[model samples]
Target chain A: MPTINVTLYGDIAQYGSGKQLATLDLDLPQDANIGLLLERIRLPSEERGYLFVNSVLHDVPGLNASHNDPLKDGDHVGIFSISHMWPYQYRQGIHLSDTLKAALEEKGVMKNTYRE
Target chain B: MARKILRIKMDDLSYKYEEVPSKWAKWGGRGLTSNIVAEEVDPTCHPLGPNNKLVIAPGWVSGTPAAPSSGRTSFGGKSPLTGGIKESNSGGTSSQKIAKLGLAAIILEGMPKDSKWYVLVITKDGVKFEEANDLLGKGMYEVDEILWKKYPNKPAIIGIGMVGEKKLSNAGISVNDPENKPGRYAGRGGLGAVMGARGVKAIVVDDTGGPGVEIANMDLFKTGRKKLTDAITSHDLTKPGGGLNSYGTNVLMNIINEAGGLPTRNFSAGYFEGASKISGEMIAETVEKRGGGMTGHGCHTGCIIKCSNIYPDEDGNDLVSPVEYETAMSLGSNCGIDDLDYIAKMTYQCDDLGLDTIEAGNTIAVYMDSGALEFGDKEGALSLFDEIRQMTPLGRILGQGVKATAEAFGVFRVPTIKGQSMPAYEPRAIKGIGVTYATTPMGADHTAGYTIAPEIAGVGGKVDPLSDEGKSELSLTFQAATAFIDSTGYCLFIAFPILDIPEGWAGMAESVAGVTGQSITGDDVISIGKEILKVERDFNTRAGFTAADDRPPEFMRYEKLPPHNEVWTVSDKALDEVFAWVNS
Candidate 1:
């Protein structure tokens, strides 16, 4: 088993420690991915707005492409509620996970909200 | 009805109405102001001297009912802070009021011969000047209250505080919001000092029963307005209960912090441990917990994407109207102060003092870095405002802004570009915005060209925030687009949806065309933006600014920021390439 630090923000905190910001550490199997971690925390994928794996953006609300990203020991995951948003200009040139980069490239253009 | 230009000569208390010059017939906002300054003002003239003139103008669609969030007013003058051509705009009732009064622009010319300050009252009849002895040396909050009570109709009030009256380089002009709170400010480049030096304390615009703004094509205007409205209302970030409406602009704190570009502790580092405490999530939570506060408050009437908020004290009393992300970062994390209440109080103090919050916060952080006070010294930080109010010699240096304060304290790691302090974003961590900060005519401003959208949010196209590739073109595109958007009197937030939705962008241009009765396309918008930039750059060139001025602070090139440990890697040639179109 491996432990991962998780911080939940906004309305999604109810799924964790029930505070505006909840930071907790969870033990997971080595084979666990982001999807399994979300399942363990009881946070539905549809309810999450932004997902950050160790300060690098991995998933936006509608663009859920990082579920298969493998979790390592001591990985930090930050999740926000649907009300949270990261506007393009403010976050321009920000670091992104490889998973997110490929997903965004497939989508071609970045929008405030995404639909399948 | 043709809109009239109101010219007030302060030298002898004279006024005249001039017809719109045919060359400038379709110009408004920054486009009009920059052109007027370039044409009429001597480039080498002192910003606070008699040779400098202050020009105020609303956008083409301002005061029209069909356009949402089109009530922005621009204040232009040579900035005492940056010694460059500057146009700082704010959202309030003044833009709509001035437009409804059938005025295209108001030019304040020549310093007054008399020592006494005067207030200008603009109405349907004409302009009247009254002595402002009673209102002298007052804070903007007090001045707004006095003017509101004295005036018959609920007129829009524009005034300055003691900082402006003293002609400090960091002072900003204050405009009263719809709630009569003097929190809305044209808060960059020290334009307030220009207003103060001209011996004008305030301008009251009474548009009651005045001739309203004339719309040339009602059908086109309606069509464009509907498309824009739909785009704004449907966007997840701007629509009702969306990110902005729920958290206000402070929402950027966490995301920027997460991205390691928050500029914590005077730009010494990229991350702040206490960022979450003062973030948008915390602000929204506090607003809900504290009963009297509200989210989604509009700065002006008819704003569909309401991102402003009213922060309340523990007792449910109003603390501040908006504690935005830039202010929170500057006054909070940048200074190492995590307390939201203190940040709100500092925000209120900046509003009342008519000081640019970003500059003031950076100055204090620089002072803290200089060993004057410890980081997160709440009481010490609060006491510095008293020094400014009392006009102590030390206070004067702090009020002059970050560069001045750093020089005064012999600190070498100053985070400024072109003599103006950098806003919230740390340039080393985010290279694209670094290009924008270096190249914009307005010194170190984020809103000048917000590349963070494509780099971070993937709004237009995805770009790696850490990569330096194609950053020059990214900044150039955003800068030109921003210049055009600023001219339309629309809030810059519209860029989010418009960038993603083609119809929204088309609607923006169409709405302006409908008002001016001119055919406008996307190409026309880009050209107009480029034209404005040319006028401003030409003025700066004449004022003795060189390509050297369009580079990042020397410290940025050498200092490595943390979390990423990256230095400003954009090439000098790349920086110059941003405005390569100027010479062409």
Candidate 2:
């Protein structure tokens, strides 16, 4: 049972206290994806924002995997809500979750687009 | 409304109105100031001497409903602090007033031979030189109150405090906000010292019955302005209840601390344990409880974002309007103090004294490093404000800025570049902004190119904040974008939405085109930004700045910031390549 210590920020803190790291001890499978972790935290699947695995902004510069992407065991994931992504529409052409993309359009937040 | 240049010759106290030169016709704000200083003022001239000219200009969009946050004014001169070309821009009512007065640029050249201080008042009628001797040695608050009472018609005042009058390098020019508080400061690079050298206490502009900004294409202006407004209101970071709007810019306290790069205790550590106490959430909650305080306060008119906030005391009396993120972090976390009340008090002192809060915090932190007091001695820090007022030898040294203080005490670990102190962001943990801090001609000033937006906050796109890869290009791109944005007189906060939204970016360029009828494309704005950078860099080059000058402090490269434990690893070769794309 590999546990991921997840920290939530801004509006995402509503899902957890954020005072302490939410110990996610779901004991999920090896190389479990970020969606599974987000589901465990009870954060909505449609929530659009940034997820940093460790100190890096996820999926930006083709450096790391994004929210919909896979997470390695013992990874520390930090979530920033969609409001944080406003200025950069998911830096460096990231492929967001379908639910997030749909929600962005539905909320009239943006076109769920990325600048090349 | 035709634009004119108002030149005040301090040598004989004569003023002249000249036609805006053809080359300077398209430029305004930072663009005009840098161009004039680079072309006319000698770079090697003494920054506080007669040869140095203090150029003040409003952004092109000022006095026009072009963008939500476009009332920024630019103060440019040879920096007495950085010893390089400097442009310090701030948002206040003054820029709009200056623009409405039909002046493209108000330039003060030549130093006075006598020591008498005067106030230069501009109106639709003419310029009046009144004896400001009575107001001499007074703080900006009293000075502003005196000037406002005398004018009574709500004229915009650009004045300096007692620190500036003493010609200290850390002194900053204070501008009156809409509430008549002399809080909005064009604070950096000792331009206030240059203004002090001119022996002018204040420049009061009464824009009543004056011609406003001339828009060439009303239809295009409307269309472009709507696009920008829509983007600003629609974006989550800038919209109502968004991060900046709800919590103010200090909102970054928690996020940046979590990212492990908040620059605590003079850049020794990347995280502050008490960051949450001084975080934006705490500030907002306090504001809610305090009756006198208010959030979503705009510093200038036409600002839709309203990132500024009014901080009140326990009794709900106004302490400071807009206790900014930089001031809070520099005074709070960097000094190891967690209390917001103490931070607000320090901020109020800095404002009243007309000192740059960032420099004051940095100097105090360096003083702590010398073992004069403990790291979190709030009282010790507060007491230094009194010393500054009294002008003790130690206070005078600290008033000169962080570089001078460190040099005076022979203290190492002085976190400054180009004689200017670092802002809130610690460079060791955040490498991209570190690159920007080192490379930008404006010294360690973060607003020069806020790569923190994309690198940390995901504005343009998240580049790894801790990594050096793809940073030179990112920094260069941001520097070019920011230079142009600063010229337009838009608040740097707008970069968040504009970076992510193409419509927002396009609309900004279009708005400029509509106002000036210049047919400016998005690409042309980039060129304009690059041109501005070239002018600044050329001036710095002639001013004796070199590649060696373009670097973070020696300790930053060697010392590893804790929690992150990351040393600044950006190579010189990469940093040297930052300006390569400026021409192309």
Candidate 3:
């Protein structure tokens, strides 16, 4: 079985809720697609957490779920909550300006591309 | 030459207005409030008892149309949340209005016996106590709208929210800025709760239709104001070109997050992964794209640096920035809330309900940690805020502040010191503020000793934000210097630029005296600040709180923060050194 740590956004980091992050060690065969991991994690049901691997955000099938992307051993699976700028509708706080948004989206911020 | 001391002794409603004997006015602001509070208030008394008095005063350079000078207001009161002295300040329309009315300070003493309310309206004529029961059970906006409608023009109002009305320990006093938004708060400890216990709802000071303030020389005042405004306009921080003036403080959400000091999720993590989504840049874009653009408005009159915003809905409905750092961290990161709108709603509710955003955010986080509520449940958080308004038995305990909430639920992982909820910065992460939280007369206050200017921004040197080297001394210097700036009634943001430039802040005393005609100097500023510190310390000492009670929570020492894997291991010996310095 492959094991990895997962984290949810601070406001709702625990399990059993929408927008939650969790890491489940997968025992599925190497040939399994990304959809299998999405079925495995409960985050989508709660709409609380986003799924990511390493740094790049991915769908429920989990990272390497794409046919073009393949999971390797010791791969890190990461889950992140939506940023305060999520939904792109309520960014009235600091760092939510349009220029910041363009910069973030350009850097694939919501897609988990920016680290710092 | 003007009145300096605004004294309210004991529980009596009778108050005295006296001058600070010329010497103290030179050291106005935090220097003044701390001195007065320490002299008049028993530091050891019950924070909510009859002994504690809430003191509100404008800066030394107030009343003049001198750029950012008229915006700042200094507030000091015994903290119901921290169980020690508390001082919180804000930039809003109220301070200028108050100064214009020819009052130096407004003190609220004595708790009213009734469940009724009284509103203090200080006009040019005199102070009028208007019965405020009709404005009862109202949020800040409702009160603002009513008062704005009734008074029409130049009605600068400060009021408490529902949280204070119920006497919750984490309540904060709310004031409307130039934007007429009740989001600007004198928030930190539960000062509003204290006002609630005393049955005071609102304080409105309007100089219009009243006598205007007296200036030493109108020509000199105009020239002084123009010079000051020009200076502000030229400086990038306060200038029109600055993002702060254009976007207000909402711009810091991403910057602080990027800096890695933004507290996320009750101090369990350092760099919230969802930070990019909530950056200030994103907020401004959404405001425009969603057809709701309200940012960068004035908090006071004749202020060029308008760092206050009025966030509106698609239909132009307002939601306040009760959405500052404390609110962002407390409601957004601590509670697992990734969405900014949800955070803003909770923030607005806190302002309306008379609750401290930080405390309320921390309270919800505690509940999430204890299994009482699920994380990321926006509705649940909203419900908790609503429940607090009903004042249920459980709600009352929650309303008592984060410490009480954690105590009631038997949760030991709470992040509080001296019963006050820690502000936006993680102590283990920042470290120096932790020392201030423990030592400053005001319990667990971050601003009392914020080293961020020198440490992170290099107002002095490029001090490392993360390292522990000389943090104690750094915090000490920050506290003392900040007190001096605070007393001058100079806005702290101005202090930011001053601290940044070489020897910029050093000339602050002369600049203040130059404006106020008080003839103060640098050496005098230092002594006055020290005097203020001594008074605050003596107040705490008389209140029976010894050095033993000044430590941070034990968990901070044992529990290692992730990313850094560091605990608060700064020895008590080191902390004791600060107390000795205070005595020395």
Candidate 4:
């Protein structure tokens, strides 16, 4: 078995302690699927809303983790609990391009951005 | 009232009859009017011009014995708010009573000469226009009082206040309730300005204790009414009269604030620390404690959910009209005044003077940010409305719109989309609402495509509020469904439960079928809504407004709201998809 370090950003941090960052260590068989991670910690979000590492709505059924696609190390993850938080989780890719990031950094808003 | 429209051209005050379209029979009430306006009215024309037609419709289940279904009506036009299309519905005896008079949509055209005020009276007897000046420049409440004394024994009245009298951009049309009070307003969109420009001061419809609506199949209507009313009474949103009925819209202050997207002090921040003091709970307590009125007032007859109320000052004086979540957030939070009483006074001033809450709120936000008025300053804010009434330079720019205000003050982040002002929700946060504000043809309206039903009320499949993927599709679906529901003239609040039961819309439509001597279905309902969208779309295209006007402010994508620290990440390219219905 190999242990993988998983980091949570955006709403997932708020779910645990309202922080902007969190990390969890999970032990699984080699090349485990991404679904196994959410199954390990079923978010107790009473809001009945969720976000995936890839910023999807996490609409998968059941907690079974082996069915999903495999994940690699250093991949960014996010979880959202509020029903309206869906737009924010998926936007890290749209405006966070390298050039855009540089521009945002120059503008000073790129600081405190969620990162691993 | 079935299969009819009281098509009145104001040019010579002449009238004609038009048979109700088959698609419209299922989508009764405001829903019908909105559809007609969208299809026929040119969006780019002057909202007060003859090119703009008003569609006044009763609900599919309206003009019946269904509790809370009898007293509603919707007014549709190309809005002065967002410079798009609008169908603002209100509750009063007018819709129910007018439908009883067998008039469907009241299409008014040709601007009347100045110094003239006309009243359109619809009764079982006939439709006639009577010059109305005894009611000119009167407050809404006062207008209702005079009309009530003139026509007793159940007559409905709709009027324009002083704001409309001036044809200000932030005017609203008012209607009287069962109590003969002009508390009900065709509130948003500055349609009242359109009415004011026509020199129409008040409308009186006397049922005269006359026979009510011509019920086609009474048995079917009764059965459907029982079920629909029960559903309304049973739902948590409508139960305990739900949030809207219990505390009116004030319930939203805490809800939006807790979400941390209330847009305090002109979008400077999201949270208002003094929110609880101006909350619905506080209003309820204050009214009950001070021997003042606090309970919600029904906008129309047969409404199980009474989401309207007339809030009074501490001395038991009517300070303003009923203040809601949007008004509170706009004037209270957005303007940074946490005082409920002050908010109530401001609310009363707008209603009595006939101003749109969204515009007033937007004006306050602009003033606070420009240092013309300090944040949380109630006195200064109240004086601003007075200045607008006086037609000051600041008032003129503020009256034109939020965009105008920003330009006059030279502020970058004006928080307006199109030419219209943004409501309570802060863009760059509240992603679902931001999507709604961005794409709705009505322009930055929270009510145009209310995502709160799903986002906050836990209504259907969970659509991620923050995600932009599939959001265009999501907003399109919601706005379409909403357009259908709105055309029906049924209260949009009923949507809380209607979303759960697929049959709910059909059942309501079935009652409409029984009344109209026509048959309709849920599928027909969607088509009608789609057709309505196309109509509004074509109107805009004719008026030279392109797809470019649909996106939110540029700052929305960059500025991250606090607490959430999120900006609107959705791309304009994605936003263009929401309007794909235009091409289709």
Candidate 5:
């Protein structure tokens, strides 16, 4: 099992188990993606929000399948409810520039390209 | 169908209609106002004296249904506050009303010799000046209520509060919102004081029988309108359930706070422990639990973003409609007051007293720094309102603005640029916005160039908030784009969708082209925006402003904001480069 640091912002703080930026050591198996992380955090299903994995925004995948990108150890994740307007709309789900995307991927992080 | 300009010569209380000059034919809103002020008014004249002129013009698409967000009006004059050229824009039904009446701009010139108050009644028949001595010294809400009831036709009322009558440097002109609430304000610079100097209390515009906006190409207008409506409704930020629609701009509280840039307690700290108390989420929840309050209220018709809200008290009575992010932060955590209701009351007081909330917030914070009162003193903060209402000597000084308040007590940490008070964002933590605050001709106005979109909100493109790398270009581009947007009568919120969605930009250009028959391309927007800034900068230059006036306060460069523990480090060479292209 590996641990990760997660932070909640905007309205998601209400559902963050009464914590905004706490190191929640999650006991999850290897290759666990954002879907499993969501399930562990117990974010209500009705609520819509955006995810930022290692400072790169990620699109919410479809219900039938999970965008289970392999999560590495020490990856930082930020969860913000949809109530929080996603300001970086240019990179809504992914950075368009190949140069930026390549740089993001080089840092052991997934680009916001993978979606259902 | 020629649009007329209503020119009111205040020195003689005579008015006449003039043809819109061919040179100014393509201009509207900020573009029109800036040109009129620069061409006519003496830049070196006292802003509230006989030589200054006030020009009020609507955007090109204001009355037209071409853009859902197109209803903004611009008020421009030499600013008594910043002592430079100023253009303040606001959203309300009044702009559309004025546009429908086929008037391009209402120019108020000269000053009255006597204190006899007057009201300008503008109907489809003609303009009539009536005595309004009975209405002076009344709150804006009261004036609106009385005039709106007397008119019975729900005419759009544009007036000022007692602060303007008192000629306070920070006084703002108020316009009625969609609900007839005098809540919308062209609320910067001291334009209201300019209007007060003309002895005009209010302008009631009724477009009941007037011809609507003339469009050159109706089919193209429809096409462009459809494209823009689709873009605004589809974009994640402008559509329903989007950030602005769901939580208003106040949603920025946590994001900016998370980015470690939200100014607290007079910019002393970057982070406030009590920020969440006044967060958009908390306001929405409080409004939900209390009832009578609405989360998504539009300031004007066709405003789909609905970023405004109605805050209610614990008993479900309306306290204030539209507590904006700037007002929330400036009066809330920025003043060390965490109580949302208390902040709402202060917002109401500012509106009622005709003071710019951003300026009032900084002035109050300076009072705290001067040991007049302690931070988070709810009673003390509330007492400041009473003092202002009564217009005591101290109240009069505070009403003058942040610079006056700072000088009164000899406080050095005055967070201002070009005499105008800074808004909610702390410059040290958000370096890109700091560059904007330093370089914008409008003097510390965030809306002049909202680099926050990219720096913190990540709207157009992501820029590191703490870095100075590409900020000058970003601020320059945003300022140019914003000037054009402000000219089009479209709400600034439209930028969120149009910034990333190319179709949205094309649609805006198409809308202007269709309405004006001018074939405006995207490149044309850039040139037009740039031209407007140059016009403003030229006026300011003639008014004696220089490169030294373009930088933020000395404290911003010296004092380090917490959380990031950074000071403003943007070079002056880059600051001067912001307007270099104007000369080129």
Candidate 6:
């Protein structure tokens, strides 16, 4: 088993420590991925707005590409509620995970919002 | 009822109306102001001298009901702070009123021979100047209250405070919001000092019974308006209860901190531990608990995206209308202060004193780095406002802005480009914005080109924020696009939806076409934006700006910011390429 540091923000924090912002450490199986971590915390994938793995963007609401990427030990993950936004202008040239980068390239143009 | 220009000769205390010249008929807002300043004012004249002129204009669709968030007003002049051409715009009722009154622009020129301060009252009939002896030395809040009582019609008032009267380099022009709060501001580039130099304290615009804006093509306007309204209402980041409407612009505090680009502690660190305390989420939560405070507040009428908020004190009294993200970062995290209440008070004081919040906060931070005041000294920070009011020598030095304060105190780690302080973002961590700060003629303005959309949010396209590759092109593209948006009278927040939604961008062009009765396309809009940049850059060149002027401070290249621990690595060749197209 490995432990991962997770931080949740906005409305989604209720799924973790029941506060607006909460940081918790969770123990998971050896081959655990982001999907497993989400399931363990009972946070649905649909409710997440932005996801960052060690400050590298991995998921946006409309585009989720890192769900199956294996999580390493001591990894830090940040989850944001859909109500939270990071405009592109402010983050231009920010680092992106390979998974999200590939997905964005395949999709060609970036879309604004993602809804069920 | 045709649109006309109102020229006020402050030296003679007289005014005249002139028909819109054929060449300038198509220009509005920043486009018109920059063009007027470039054509009429001498480039080498002292920014606050008699030879300098202040030009004010609204966007083409400013007064029309069909254009949402299209009531922004632009003020243009040679900047005393940057010593370059500058256009600073703000959202308020004045733009719509000026447009409705059938005025294309207002030009204030010449220095008054008399020492008496005057207030200009503009109505449908003409302009009248009255001595403002009683309003002298008063903060903008008291001045707004007095003027509202004097004018029963509740006209839009644009005024300055003691800082402007003293002609401080950081002084900004204050515009009254819908609530009659003098918080809305064209608060950049020290334009208020120019207005002050002309011996004018305020300008009141009353549009009662005035001929409204003439729409050349009503059907096209309506079509474009509907498309844009649909895009705005549907966007998750802008609609009601969306990110902006729910928490306001201060929402960036947490995310930027998480991304290791928050510019904490005078740009020495990138992450601020106290970011969440003064974030948009905390602000909204406090506003909900406090009865008198409100979220989703509008700065002006006809704005669909109400990202503004009214923060309340502990006793349920209104403290400040909005505590913007830039202010929170510059005054809060960057200065090592985490108390939200204190930041709000500082914001209100800055607004009332007619000082540019970004410049004022950065100056204080530089002063702190100079060992005058310890970081996060709330009481000492608050007392500086009184020092400024009392006209202390030390206060005057701080009021001159970051570069001056740094030079005065012998602080070598100054964060400025072209004599203006950098905004909230750390250039060492975000290389693209560094490119923008170095290359923009406006001198380190975030709004000059916001590449954060693609770099952080993945809106238009994704880019690696840490990489220096392609940043020059990214900055060039954004700077041109932003220049166009600044001229539309529409709020820059619209960039979010328009960039993501193709129809929204088209609607913007169509709306302008409908107003001016000239067909336009997306390419034409970008071309106009580039043209505006060219005119501004040319003026700066004539004012003695060189390639050396277009760069970040040397400290940024040597000193690495924390968390990411990155220094500015963008090549100088790439920076010069940003404006190389202008000469081409």
Query: Scoring each candidate complex against the real one, what DockQ results?
Result: 0.51, 0.15, 0.03, 0.03, 0.16, 0.44
Candidate No. with top TM-score: 1
* Residue-level lDDT tens digits of model 3 in B1-584: 45434444323344466766554554455666666677677777676677678888877667765535557788887888876676788877777776666667777777655545888776665666667999988889889888888775758888898778877787888888765778778877888877776668888877775333445445544554455455556554467746466445554454344434566776676557665455454455556666665555666776666666556555656666534555777888777788877887887787778777778888888878788888778788888876787887877887887788888888898777667777766666556667777777776765675322333222334332223455556556666666776776666666544433323343455556555666555446545565677777777777667888778888888887655556777778777777586666
TM-score preference between candidates 1 and 5, better one: 1
Docking class of 4: incorrect
Cα shift from native, residue B178, model 6 (Å): 0.6
For model 1, residues A14-44, the per-residue Cα lDDT tens digits are 8886657788899999899999999998888
Q: Tally clashing residue pairs in candidate 5.
A: 4
The most accurate candidate by lDDT is 1
**Global Cα RMSD, each model:** 2.2, 5.1, 10.1, 9.6, 5.0, 2.5
lDDT of 5 by residue, B311-345 (tens): 99989999897888888888887789899999889
TM-score of each: 0.97, 0.89, 0.78, 0.79, 0.89, 0.96
Interface RMSD computed for candidate 3 is what? Answer: 13.8
In terms of lDDT, model 3 sits at 0.62
Better of 2 and 4 by lDDT: 2
DockQ score, prediction 1: 0.51
Choose the strongest candidate by DockQ.
1
lDDT of 1 by residue, B1-584 (tens): 89888999999999998998998887898889889999989999999999999999999999998598888999998999999999999998899999998888999988888788999999999889999989987998899999999997889999999999999999999999999998898999999999999899999999998899999998888888888898889887788988899888887788778778898889988889898899888888887788888989999999999999999999989988888999999999989999999999999999998899999999999999999899999889988999998899998998999999999999998888889999988888777788889999988998897322343222345444334467777777778778888888888888877766778878888888888898886557766787898999999999999999998888888888888888887789999999988877
The true-structure Cα RMSD of candidate 1 reads 2.2
lDDT of each residue in B1-584, candidate 6, tens digit only: 67899999999999999999988888889989999999998999999999999899998889998588887999999999999999999988899999999988999999889888999999988888999978989999999999998886899999998899999889999999998999888989999999999999999999998899988999898888887888788888888888899888987888878778887777888888888889887887787777778889999989998999888999989999888899998888888889999989999999999888888888888888989999889778878888888779988887889998899999998888888898877877667788898989989898898432342222234443334457777787788788887888988888888766778878888888888887776657666888999999999999999999998998888887777677888788999999998877
For candidate 4, what's the TM-score of chain A, rounded to 2 decimals? 0.40
For candidate 3, the TM-score is: 0.78
| Candidate 2 positional error at A25, Å | 13
lDDT of each candidate versus the true structure: 0.86, 0.79, 0.62, 0.64, 0.78, 0.85
Better of 3 and 6 by lDDT: 6
**Candidate 2 at A97: error in angstroms?**
18
Poorest lDDT segment (10 consecutive residues) of candidate 5 chain B: B451-460
How far in Å is the alpha carbon of B473 misplaced in model 6? Answer: 2.1
Candidate 6 segments whose C-alpha is farther than 4 A from its true place: A1-3, A17-19, A29-32, A68-75, A110-116, B451-468
When 4 and 6 are scored with DockQ, the better candidate is 6
Evaluate candidate 6 and give its CAPRI docking class based on DockQ. acceptable
Candidate 3 chain B: minimum summed lDDT over ten consecutive residues — where? Answer: B450-459
